[model samples]
Target: MTDEFASLNHFNGARDTPMPQDRLRAIRHGAEALREQLLDDPPVHFARSFDLLRIPYPAWFAFTGVYSQQLLKPHMVHLLARMAVVQYDDFEGRLRTLLFTPADFEAGNETPYFKRLAEKTPKFLHKAIAPVYNTVPQALASCGISPAQVDYITYDHLHTQDLRRWLGTPGLLPNARLLVHRQELASVRGLLPVQAEWYCPHGLDGIAAERIVPFDGSIQLGRGLALVHTPGHTEGNHSLVYRTGDGLRVSSENGVSADSWAPLSSRHDGIRRYAKATGAEVILNGNTQEGSTDQYLSMVLERTLAGTSSSHGFSNVVPSAECSPHWLFPGAPTSHLWGETSFGTPLHA
Candidate 1:
């Protein structure tokens, strides 16, 4: 109602004004420039990486339509959110921190807001162990960094967040801004009040409008990262594109797991047969109302091994580092295991 939803892509330049081909060309040019800079002068490069866990989830939740009809084996298998902390150098040659949601939720006597919300929510989620958080501050401190050093904060989508705790009425990361999709902010109204508890109450309310940067269509984050419009998991769902030394990597929840994104990695005979029959390389994020066709195309935009039997060998955009927060759990299903993590070694200055 803040005129954000009333007008599509109202805040930034908004992508609709330009022709589709022109926009695509601009994106390609920006990507090429960023790639050159990163590989040569390196305006933005991965500094280091760390992970934090929020709440544990069942394996079924990681894949769409898998175990939906009934519980599969490995009932004890658990899944949790892994917050990836990535550092970079901005175009100005200043060190910048970009946190992809450290999750930062807690349990028991740790956090009252989420604890209360959990009590009111359904019993299915209650089965997982209480969340593990509250160490995020110490974790940052150990890195010789503080919230103030952070430049940008984002999530794949606003499925759930405790961001307001650190990003308060005044501020925690004093200089940081929330880079999110305009459609995501617009879609919140349709979800809240009905599914209100899923969101942190007034979490984003106190933050100033300028502190929140919303945009439409495909947009570049600085010179190195591009946030692509891949709307399926959530109405405003987007993916983070980073040009790595290896290739272009994408980070998103559109596919709940690696196997979901790369069906060729699957060992399930049924899935293999289905893939063989349909040639579908992608699967759904399981919780969205958006169709799988769009999700599949989005997956196609992602990168995988070249010339492999399972890969299309066309995309330079590889799936970013993603790991289940509960990969260490005993008796965990094979599907719950992560094939790769976003954790990176230090980049040389």
Candidate 2:
């Protein structure tokens, strides 16, 4: 990975390299510097520009709690799933096409961990709680993109993801390959007890090694896009960074909503009090507190990288699964909903 676009901090090395507190300070400084650098001088924009397609899917109510520290009203959240279509010129000047976060909603339901929750839910409310919105491929087609045009596929992390249908046995996208973090691939191979529940047991079973592109740290794809390693949600979790017309935006599952990173400005009940009491700047997604401190720092990195959004009160770190306000979820309103956004021209058009 190039030093210019790579993560300012990494936890892959020796345990407690400098201790969590010390590392946090270093990351904070690095993030601020990078933010200023980007402001002073932005990176080259993508050749044909990039496009984003966001689709909402139903997610459990209690799981979207702020920091998962406190409980909110019990209701479902419309989790927004994003599909970023990027076209850029490589070093060799070859035009490359990437399909980021083409998540399979049907396959995702098979996760053993979520299955346990489904089994416990009353049968009458099953369809209401988890309804089908649209598949990734379907969403792509709506935007005039075909499956064959996808050159690469990736996600912030592989939680509840089943790649067998996409890259493994079924061969859904003929020319597409998976770009994943080395540590993330390892974690999927040998599941950790805490993270195992969210992953499908046989997700990557038949995928050939050649179909996956594994790398360490962070990597910049051409100019406008970079994948920054922001571990904390999972040992291998990373966030998607891209230059948008609005500004730089980072997408990850680290926090569920804008209220997550900027709790002090949030109108949600108890969130501001919670932040003040704990001296916390950001709220954890809380579903998997695998690395709380690391996640917090990683979020800080994301916040710094994207900077703040004038439209909203917090940084432009868009959660892959953003929480949308619902009548059922009365008191737990979201600060913003980046719903079904489109930027640049359609790839197929």
Candidate 3:
């Protein structure tokens, strides 16, 4: 594929333009609103027979989408550091844990991806949110769960992840296995320089190859949860769909903010006009590996899978990198929203 439409390399196009003056203010306002929502509401919740916990990771900043840092100002877009844990009942009615975007996957300087990024890049524009950075253990503890309690753990993709951190030398979560897409595992085995530094070549180093549980495509993990294939962000990118109390919800990095996923809410002047005219979608997530076509289709698939969402005309697919402070720079830090629900009320964590 040509880098023009499918690449994670830093963009440096001369085609630059300033967003409306009101855009920045709007972004700040959104950040504050989301942050407040998270503070007021707890991250965990019960939906039917399942428990969902929205885990906040360290905040980070990086140019998002195609034009974010490459073609336009490096400060137009941002992503929040959000992850989730799902507690569901198996066919036998036994409670099982399924972690999405596990803490060991991304964020923090201790990670191989960030270490290399710090050494190789100049814009090392990321910050560890000391308040929430590496707080997954605490979050898990609050719910009376631990790594040993976890049945399965998965990330949408393995971009910035180093499995060794979680699996350890002989293996840490002895009872748990890393659920990953076969295609993604293949990609990780052969890292390309053009890809983001978030993916560490030695990530799976210590773990025995058998420890990695690979799947071919979309799957129904259980009655209440599923891992749907949506390969646009990467060949192995997937979305998590769950049956909430009210309806269905999805989680993926395919789209960053709700605005990116909610076409109805993305009616701002510049963005609206551009989206309508060019037939090209822009700034959906921090990473743009495949193309708008695949990403857009993935978005559509999320809604289709949702079937009946508590939301009106939109699917509930929350992105982890959401606390973006700027619109031009997708990686800039700002605020956070644990998870938006039309799905159901969150359980306290």
Candidate 4:
């Protein structure tokens, strides 16, 4: 078995490192659970009984290391594997959808900086490698919906070039809007070193910026609602909130993966507290263990929000750093949701 497969198996707690049947079974089980939960409850606000469907965007590739720097070393193969779930209504209406930013398009492209990185950093060969297994086109095709019909494209923090490629892709809906934090757009313009590559020249075009709408705190896309929760990782990093039949679901795409749904306090205190206060039922991550999502959500919700704890104590308190005008208050959800605010006291409903 390859070292990579072995590592993944070990991480997944499989007895056999190579081709771990246990790991695959666990993954299948989790996928089935997610599908069942999504279908049974329909994770959106359905007033009455309605038909529902989910499209899985499989992970085609990943960077070897964890840190952004390590993953960024090879300029060519920086794209990460991602997936999306599109939910439709009984009338075959596109209610709402969530998708990870497609980052693979930047691989093997001949950008000036990428060329320089390849020439100067020969040691970073692993970084330049593309997905050895699944590819994005195949994953998208698997959804059975032509790419052109896709209505909304929700990205975490994709490089400008990658976003351009995705936007240019034939399958995406032309009028489909791009959702991201306002600060992220500004950060892209500022050319900050930390996010230098993310700022593609394409984003510089006023047209590109025009096509992109700034997600102040929350915005309702065709069928889904998006939330802007900027953690320190990036100035504009945000999470997404979509209403499902079960209740409101929050996708911590950048903050957590599908597998780690531990109570906010146990996994990430700030995010946990924020999600709990906001009444988010499911916490989906960008990545995770096969069974972690079900386990974490089940345990954490039972102990935390569903338990006898006081929701009033930490429920509504927004840290000064994370405040924004559009942030939902109990009674007053924003109408013109845009702009940022200073780190001040919590804004109560």
Candidate 5:
């Protein structure tokens, strides 16, 4: 299935070419076909999610409902940044390793946007968030894997990421190549006003072009791992699709929880009602409404590709930034939180 969906790659590029409903119908068919093909003979050796840290986010942006009644309050929700590890074979049939969303939290804080956000945080609250933070190296060590073992590094999007430390001078993953969407790489260099807040000023500066693998549309790295262009969260945002023992899992920051994909089944306030009232299949993580319609359709594509969780009714769309139940936001608890998942054997003995 490597190049089977080549024509459907970068579908977001032509959003105006087709009606949204028409585009959505087409996306469903493509996603369903891809899901069936990939699951039959998954080549993934191991896959799992690692906890990084939690940060405060506006409830309105996390779950934009039809009614703005509860959205206007001074409400905030906690979102957990996570990393995913997947090992598989390359086209040459040699085993390789990939790290998705392995964000360097310490380096990320240097961004003026987040740095200011941190400065405004109350001292006690800052201390609370500090305990949950984990570095990329620390997360790797927890899994008994080394930085040198990583062959590729990628993310669902470049938001809040500073890749200089990972791919620039004296990088941590010496042998790893950064896989990024061509548009995302360009967007980082020249950010729009709305995009600047979530991006690092010098994130991609000085990294040798050869060290980055920029791609358009969707591409499968190997048998079980594929990156599908699910734009709308950002113009170049793509979702990580990989096969697991259970089924296929799609990871991205497009939504914060399973509830974001299955809003009708959500227990959060107004979300379920809003879905029913508006006939919405998925809710947007409305922080960046740059392309709300496309984002909605992208979520639909993610849902179709992920199928459904046998244990949970919602699709197995693992959000990169998941909403966890916390004392910080009691009213906005997620019905389903994919804390961690590990399959097959560890990459290193």
Candidate 6:
């Protein structure tokens, strides 16, 4: 496994540190329990087309499908399948489709022989493909999750596969709402040539395009508080905010890598502004040395306040950086200093 993949499991041995024991225990317990369930039926299957199917939430909030097959017909299927494995190891197996009709698989075929060949291909190929079909089922058995639990299904970006999976898993998450970004819904509806009805629930909040700007905001969920981060690597990315008795802490998803938080913060103006404005004492990234949450958070807070001028001519105050793309990343530092300037500031005027 690459460093990125192993990073997820890096926090396995840092219990000596003074962190919130309850939250750590909850996450650890959840993962171990899920793993035990998977171990009961070892040696999972991997389908040729749909390499992996992932039902992340047991309550059926989301389902992901990856197409592993390298066939010519389903280009989108192939792309999403590769992404699932390389970018995120969230799914279990792929789906393999057998196209019998020429028109269904291809746009146009002039010759009668080719048309006949398409129809006969399934029969001749059935024997060879039968063994491949069982691979995914067997793999899932090893993974220990029953096929019955999979509520949503994906076929690359094609809606047909999602429909197929949903139909197969009837009565799954009858109450839970389906969530999808407006852009994603539009893209899927436009590309897929299916006649299935699309519905957006009242709970759907279309993501704002300006979310790329980093701002100090909080979203309170049933679990806890999640902080919205504007800059890290991806645009509109956010991180979870959790509080410990010691101080305020933020769990950044892609905020920084394991070695050091300095590099990640070096280029992030929005993070700097947030730290300065909120006076956050701790910042935690997905990849970090265990037990350093408090230390790192302090470092960020110190760095943000350093070299900043206050409106009252106090140099000890935190400096508020401009929330512009140019200063955020991939550019030189701003010529003007941020503080009580001639104009009023949004964070601390």
lDDT of each candidate versus the true structure: 0.52, 0.68, 0.52, 0.35, 0.81, 0.24
Q: lDDT tens digits, residues 1-349, model 6?
A: 1111111231233333466454345434533442233223322122111222111111010101111111111221100111010011122323211110001112112223333434655667433321122223343344343444332221111221222112212422222222222333454334322112221121113323222111222222212112222222222223322222222223222221111123223233543444455444323331112224433432342223222223322122111111111211222222232221111111100
3 or 4, greater by TM-score: 3
Tens-digit lDDT track for model 5 on 1-349? Answer: 2242232353444455457787788778778888887788565998877888887787888877633645223377789888988888766777788999988777788766668878988878875754466778887888788889998999988888888888888899898888888888888878888788888778888899888988888887877788998888888899999888888889998998888899888876577777877899997888777688888888998999999987979889989998786675666558887887777876782
* Candidate 5 pairs with clashing backbones: 10-217
Question: lDDT score of model 4?
Answer: 0.35
What stretches of model 2 exceed 4 Å from their correct place? Answer: 1-19, 36-71, 75-78, 122-124
Could you give the C-alpha RMSD of every candidate to the true structure, in order shown? 7.1, 4.1, 12.1, 19.9, 2.7, 22.9
lDDT of 1 by residue, 1-349 (tens): 2222222121133233446445334434443444444334333456333444434444554555555534244443344455455666554555657776555454222333345646776767554454443355665675567677777878777766655655666666777778778888877646644345345544565667777878776665544555666665666767765555454556676665555655555655544454565666665555445545445544544433111222332233322323243533454323334432453443322
| Candidate order by decreasing TM-score | 5, 2, 1, 3, 4, 6
- Candidate 1 runs further than 4 Å off: 1-43, 58-60, 68-77, 107-128, 131-134, 192-197, 304-349
lDDT: which candidate is best? 5
Clashes of 6: 19
Report the poorest 10 consecutive residues by lDDT, candidate 3.
2-11
Candidate 4 structure quality by residue, lDDT tens digits, 248-272: 3443333223212333333334334
| Candidate 4 Cα deviation (angstroms), residue 114 | 7.9
Q: After the best TM-score superposition of candidate 6, give how far the Cα of residue 87 lies from its true spot, in angstroms.
A: 15
lDDT of 5: 0.81
Stretches of model 5 off by over 4 angstroms after superposition:
1-16, 66-74
Query: Among these predicted structures, which one has the highest TM-score?
Result: 5
Q: On TM-score, who's better, 1 or 4?
A: 1
Residue 139 displacement in candidate 4 (angstroms):
2.3
- Residue 318's lDDT within candidate 5 is 89
Return the TM-score for each candidate structure.
0.69, 0.85, 0.68, 0.44, 0.93, 0.22
